[model samples]
Target: MRAGGTSELKQPSEEVQQLLETVKTELEEKMERKLDKFLLVSYKTQVVAGTNYFAKIDIGGEELVHLRVYKNLQGEVSLHSHQHPKTREEDIQYF
Candidate 1:
Protein backbone atom coordinates (compact mmCIF):
# COMPACT_ATOMS: atom_id res chain seq x y z
CA MET A 1 0.00 0.00 0.00
CA ARG A 2 1.08 3.60 -0.69
CA ALA A 3 1.70 5.85 2.25
CA GLY A 4 2.32 9.48 3.07
CA GLY A 5 3.14 10.47 -0.52
CA THR A 6 6.42 8.73 0.00
CA SER A 7 7.86 5.80 -1.88
CA GLU A 8 5.91 2.58 -2.19
CA LEU A 9 5.42 0.69 1.02
CA LYS A 10 8.30 -1.58 1.89
CA GLN A 11 7.43 -5.17 2.47
CA PRO A 12 8.52 -6.71 5.74
CA SER A 13 8.74 -10.33 6.73
CA GLU A 14 5.53 -12.01 7.84
CA GLU A 15 6.48 -11.82 11.50
CA VAL A 16 7.45 -8.21 11.29
CA GLN A 17 4.33 -7.32 9.39
CA GLN A 18 2.15 -8.90 12.04
CA LEU A 19 3.97 -7.07 14.79
CA LEU A 20 3.64 -3.81 12.94
CA GLU A 21 -0.08 -4.27 12.53
CA THR A 22 -0.55 -5.04 16.20
CA VAL A 23 1.30 -1.95 17.17
CA LYS A 24 -0.67 0.16 14.76
CA THR A 25 -4.00 -1.12 16.02
CA GLU A 26 -3.09 -0.65 19.66
CA LEU A 27 -1.92 2.88 19.06
CA GLU A 28 -5.02 3.83 17.15
CA GLU A 29 -7.29 2.49 19.85
CA LYS A 30 -5.34 3.82 22.80
CA MET A 31 -4.93 7.26 21.33
CA GLU A 32 -8.48 7.31 19.93
CA ARG A 33 -7.30 8.61 16.55
CA LYS A 34 -7.21 7.19 13.08
CA LEU A 35 -3.99 7.05 11.10
CA ASP A 36 -4.33 8.20 7.55
CA LYS A 37 -1.09 6.69 6.34
CA PHE A 38 1.74 4.38 7.32
CA LEU A 39 5.35 4.44 6.24
CA LEU A 40 7.60 1.57 7.13
CA VAL A 41 11.33 1.77 7.54
CA SER A 42 13.29 -1.37 8.30
CA TYR A 43 16.97 -2.12 8.44
CA LYS A 44 19.64 -4.12 10.15
CA THR A 45 22.59 -2.63 11.96
CA GLN A 46 25.86 -4.50 12.12
CA VAL A 47 27.14 -2.48 15.03
CA VAL A 48 23.94 -2.84 17.01
CA ALA A 49 23.54 -6.46 15.86
CA GLY A 50 19.80 -6.45 15.36
CA THR A 51 16.96 -5.41 13.13
CA ASN A 52 14.90 -2.27 13.61
CA TYR A 53 11.39 -1.61 12.48
CA PHE A 54 9.64 1.72 12.46
CA ALA A 55 6.16 2.70 11.39
CA LYS A 56 5.88 6.37 10.60
CA ILE A 57 2.39 7.75 10.54
CA ASP A 58 0.83 10.71 8.78
CA ILE A 59 -2.55 12.24 9.45
CA GLY A 60 -4.52 14.52 7.11
CA GLY A 61 -1.45 15.14 4.90
CA GLU A 62 -0.43 18.14 6.93
CA GLU A 63 2.98 16.72 7.90
CA LEU A 64 2.83 18.91 10.96
CA VAL A 65 2.66 15.97 13.36
CA HIS A 66 3.62 12.30 13.16
CA LEU A 67 4.06 9.18 15.23
CA ARG A 68 6.65 6.45 15.11
CA VAL A 69 6.23 2.91 16.35
CA TYR A 70 9.56 1.30 16.98
CA LYS A 71 10.52 -2.32 17.56
CA ASN A 72 14.05 -2.97 18.68
CA LEU A 73 16.14 -5.90 19.72
CA GLN A 74 14.84 -8.13 22.52
CA GLY A 75 11.41 -7.71 20.92
CA GLU A 76 10.68 -4.52 22.75
CA VAL A 77 8.26 -2.09 21.19
CA SER A 78 7.69 1.57 21.86
CA LEU A 79 5.76 4.47 20.43
CA HIS A 80 6.99 7.98 19.98
CA SER A 81 6.10 11.07 18.02
CA HIS A 82 7.45 14.25 16.49
CA GLN A 83 5.95 17.53 15.49
CA HIS A 84 7.18 20.27 13.24
CA PRO A 85 8.86 23.11 14.99
CA LYS A 86 6.46 25.92 15.73
CA THR A 87 9.04 28.55 14.84
CA ARG A 88 12.03 28.60 12.58
CA GLU A 89 14.28 29.14 15.55
CA GLU A 90 12.86 26.23 17.46
CA ASP A 91 14.48 22.86 17.34
CA ILE A 92 12.60 19.72 16.46
CA GLN A 93 12.26 17.06 19.11
CA TYR A 94 11.85 13.32 18.60
CA PHE A 95 10.36 11.35 21.44
Candidate 2:
Protein backbone atom coordinates (compact mmCIF):
# COMPACT_ATOMS: atom_id res chain seq x y z
CA MET A 1 0.00 0.00 0.00
CA ARG A 2 1.14 3.56 -0.67
CA ALA A 3 2.25 5.73 2.18
CA GLY A 4 -0.70 7.36 3.99
CA GLY A 5 -3.15 5.21 2.09
CA THR A 6 -5.19 2.46 3.70
CA SER A 7 -5.29 -0.96 2.18
CA GLU A 8 -8.44 -2.86 1.43
CA LEU A 9 -9.81 -5.02 4.23
CA LYS A 10 -8.52 -8.55 3.97
CA GLN A 11 -8.16 -11.77 5.93
CA PRO A 12 -5.80 -11.72 8.87
CA SER A 13 -2.37 -13.10 8.09
CA GLU A 14 0.15 -14.79 10.39
CA GLU A 15 1.82 -11.42 10.76
CA VAL A 16 -1.40 -9.82 11.97
CA GLN A 17 -1.97 -12.61 14.50
CA GLN A 18 1.53 -12.15 15.83
CA LEU A 19 0.96 -8.41 16.10
CA LEU A 20 -2.19 -8.99 18.14
CA GLU A 21 -0.41 -11.46 20.39
CA THR A 22 2.31 -8.92 21.03
CA VAL A 23 -0.26 -6.65 22.63
CA LYS A 24 -2.70 -9.27 23.90
CA THR A 25 -1.94 -8.53 27.53
CA GLU A 26 -2.34 -4.82 27.07
CA LEU A 27 -5.49 -5.41 25.09
CA GLU A 28 -7.05 -7.55 27.78
CA GLU A 29 -6.13 -4.98 30.37
CA LYS A 30 -7.68 -2.16 28.40
CA MET A 31 -10.73 -4.26 27.64
CA GLU A 32 -11.20 -4.79 31.36
CA ARG A 33 -11.63 -8.50 30.77
CA LYS A 34 -10.02 -11.51 29.19
CA LEU A 35 -10.98 -12.49 25.69
CA ASP A 36 -12.99 -15.67 25.34
CA LYS A 37 -12.75 -15.59 21.59
CA PHE A 38 -10.44 -14.05 18.97
CA LEU A 39 -11.97 -14.45 15.60
CA LEU A 40 -10.33 -12.06 13.13
CA VAL A 41 -12.85 -10.98 10.55
CA SER A 42 -10.75 -8.61 8.43
CA TYR A 43 -8.15 -5.83 8.50
CA LYS A 44 -6.98 -2.75 6.66
CA THR A 45 -3.42 -1.44 6.67
CA GLN A 46 -1.98 2.04 6.21
CA VAL A 47 1.59 3.06 5.51
CA VAL A 48 3.00 5.79 7.70
CA ALA A 49 6.20 6.50 9.68
CA GLY A 50 5.27 2.99 10.74
CA THR A 51 2.46 0.79 9.49
CA ASN A 52 -1.03 0.99 10.99
CA TYR A 53 -3.49 -1.90 11.06
CA PHE A 54 -7.21 -1.44 11.55
CA ALA A 55 -8.73 -4.76 12.44
CA LYS A 56 -12.18 -6.12 13.19
CA ILE A 57 -12.15 -8.91 15.74
CA ASP A 58 -15.11 -11.03 16.71
CA ILE A 59 -14.93 -11.42 20.46
CA GLY A 60 -18.05 -13.61 20.46
CA GLY A 61 -21.46 -13.86 18.90
CA GLU A 62 -22.42 -10.42 17.58
CA GLU A 63 -19.91 -8.57 19.72
CA LEU A 64 -16.78 -7.28 18.05
CA VAL A 65 -13.96 -4.79 18.41
CA HIS A 66 -12.05 -2.50 16.11
CA LEU A 67 -8.35 -2.23 16.81
CA ARG A 68 -5.73 0.12 15.51
CA VAL A 69 -2.27 -1.27 16.02
CA TYR A 70 1.02 0.11 14.81
CA LYS A 71 4.24 -1.55 13.76
CA ASN A 72 7.17 0.83 13.69
CA LEU A 73 9.95 0.91 11.13
CA GLN A 74 12.04 -1.14 13.53
CA GLY A 75 9.21 -3.68 13.61
CA GLU A 76 7.99 -3.17 17.16
CA VAL A 77 4.25 -3.59 17.50
CA SER A 78 1.95 -1.66 19.84
CA LEU A 79 -1.74 -1.21 20.40
CA HIS A 80 -2.63 2.31 19.33
CA SER A 81 -6.35 2.37 19.98
CA HIS A 82 -9.56 0.34 20.03
CA GLN A 83 -13.37 0.51 19.62
CA HIS A 84 -15.51 -2.04 21.39
CA PRO A 85 -19.03 -3.49 21.17
CA LYS A 86 -19.08 -3.25 17.41
CA THR A 87 -21.43 -5.30 15.28
CA ARG A 88 -20.77 -7.41 12.18
CA GLU A 89 -22.69 -4.90 10.07
CA GLU A 90 -20.45 -2.01 11.07
CA ASP A 91 -17.84 -1.05 8.54
CA ILE A 92 -14.33 -1.31 9.95
CA GLN A 93 -12.55 1.95 9.28
CA TYR A 94 -10.06 4.26 10.93
CA PHE A 95 -11.32 5.16 14.37
Candidate 3:
Protein backbone atom coordinates (compact mmCIF):
# COMPACT_ATOMS: atom_id res chain seq x y z
CA MET A 1 0.00 0.00 0.00
CA ARG A 2 0.98 3.66 -0.45
CA ALA A 3 0.34 6.60 1.84
CA GLY A 4 1.13 10.32 1.97
CA GLY A 5 1.49 12.54 5.00
CA THR A 6 3.24 15.69 6.24
CA SER A 7 6.60 14.00 6.46
CA GLU A 8 6.74 12.41 3.01
CA LEU A 9 5.20 9.81 0.73
CA LYS A 10 5.73 6.25 1.84
CA GLN A 11 7.00 3.85 -0.77
CA PRO A 12 4.70 0.97 -1.61
CA SER A 13 5.89 -2.55 -2.13
CA GLU A 14 7.03 -3.65 -5.59
CA GLU A 15 3.72 -5.46 -6.16
CA VAL A 16 1.70 -2.44 -5.11
CA GLN A 17 3.82 -0.20 -7.30
CA GLN A 18 3.15 -2.41 -10.28
CA LEU A 19 -0.58 -2.44 -9.53
CA LEU A 20 -0.67 1.34 -9.38
CA GLU A 21 1.10 1.57 -12.69
CA THR A 22 -1.39 -0.76 -14.26
CA VAL A 23 -4.30 1.22 -12.89
CA LYS A 24 -2.85 4.47 -14.21
CA THR A 25 -2.32 3.00 -17.64
CA GLU A 26 -5.85 1.63 -17.79
CA LEU A 27 -7.35 4.93 -16.71
CA GLU A 28 -5.34 6.87 -19.24
CA GLU A 29 -6.34 4.58 -22.02
CA LYS A 30 -10.02 4.57 -21.11
CA MET A 31 -10.29 8.29 -20.41
CA GLU A 32 -7.91 9.33 -23.19
CA ARG A 33 -6.22 11.81 -20.90
CA LYS A 34 -2.69 12.09 -19.67
CA LEU A 35 -2.31 11.84 -15.91
CA ASP A 36 0.47 14.07 -14.73
CA LYS A 37 0.71 13.45 -11.01
CA PHE A 38 -1.21 11.29 -8.57
CA LEU A 39 -1.48 11.80 -4.82
CA LEU A 40 -2.29 8.65 -2.87
CA VAL A 41 -3.75 9.10 0.58
CA SER A 42 -5.59 7.23 3.32
CA TYR A 43 -4.03 3.94 2.46
CA LYS A 44 -5.10 1.01 4.60
CA THR A 45 -4.62 -2.75 4.44
CA GLN A 46 -6.48 -5.70 5.92
CA VAL A 47 -5.37 -9.29 6.04
CA VAL A 48 -7.46 -12.37 6.76
CA ALA A 49 -8.48 -15.20 4.47
CA GLY A 50 -7.51 -12.73 1.76
CA THR A 51 -5.88 -9.33 1.47
CA ASN A 52 -7.85 -6.14 1.01
CA TYR A 53 -6.29 -2.75 0.27
CA PHE A 54 -7.89 0.64 -0.11
CA ALA A 55 -6.79 4.17 -0.89
CA LYS A 56 -7.78 7.44 -2.50
CA ILE A 57 -6.13 8.87 -5.55
CA ASP A 58 -6.02 12.56 -6.28
CA ILE A 59 -5.48 13.18 -9.96
CA GLY A 60 -4.09 16.66 -10.48
CA GLY A 61 -6.79 18.15 -8.26
CA GLU A 62 -9.31 17.57 -10.98
CA GLU A 63 -10.77 14.50 -9.37
CA LEU A 64 -10.53 12.30 -6.33
CA VAL A 65 -11.11 8.59 -6.84
CA HIS A 66 -11.36 5.66 -4.45
CA LEU A 67 -9.44 2.50 -5.10
CA ARG A 68 -10.11 -0.99 -3.80
CA VAL A 69 -7.62 -3.75 -4.46
CA TYR A 70 -8.10 -7.32 -3.39
CA LYS A 71 -6.05 -10.48 -3.64
CA ASN A 72 -7.43 -13.90 -3.03
CA LEU A 73 -5.80 -17.10 -1.91
CA GLN A 74 -5.59 -18.28 -5.50
CA GLY A 75 -3.34 -15.25 -6.23
CA GLU A 76 -6.08 -13.53 -8.20
CA VAL A 77 -6.06 -9.75 -8.03
CA SER A 78 -8.97 -7.36 -8.50
CA LEU A 79 -8.91 -3.61 -8.84
CA HIS A 80 -11.89 -1.29 -8.74
CA SER A 81 -12.39 2.48 -8.66
CA HIS A 82 -15.25 4.85 -8.06
CA GLN A 83 -15.72 8.60 -7.82
CA HIS A 84 -15.26 9.82 -4.27
CA PRO A 85 -18.29 11.37 -2.66
CA LYS A 86 -18.24 15.08 -1.84
CA THR A 87 -19.11 16.29 1.62
CA ARG A 88 -21.81 18.94 2.10
CA GLU A 89 -23.67 20.44 4.99
CA GLU A 90 -27.38 21.03 5.16
CA ASP A 91 -29.86 22.37 7.69
CA ILE A 92 -31.63 19.66 9.65
CA GLN A 93 -35.14 20.08 11.00
CA TYR A 94 -36.41 17.59 13.53
CA PHE A 95 -40.11 16.85 13.74
Per-prediction count of colliding residue pairs? 0, 0, 0
For model 3, residues 12-82, the per-residue Cα lDDT tens digits are 46556565555676656655778786556444555645665565566665565556666678866666544
How do the predictions measure up, each by TM-score? 0.37, 0.89, 0.51
> Largest lDDT belongs to which candidate?
2
Question: What overall lDDT, based on C-alpha atoms, would model 3 receive against the true structure?
Answer: 0.52
lDDT of each: 0.42, 0.85, 0.52
lDDT of 2 by residue, 1-95 (tens): 55577998788787787677787788899989998887678899888898888999888878899999999999989999999889998888777
lDDT score at residue 82, model 1, on the 0-100 scale: 38
For model 1, residues 1-95, the per-residue Cα lDDT tens digits are: 12222233344455654665656666667557777754333311111233333333333354423334455677776654333323322322223
Give the C-alpha miss distance for residue 24 in model 1, angstroms: 2.7
Q: Tell me model 2's lDDT, rounded to 2 decimals.
A: 0.85
Superposed model 1: Cα runs more than 4 Å off: 1-9, 34-51, 56-67, 82-95
| Model 3: pairs clashing at backbone N, Cα or C within 3 Å | none
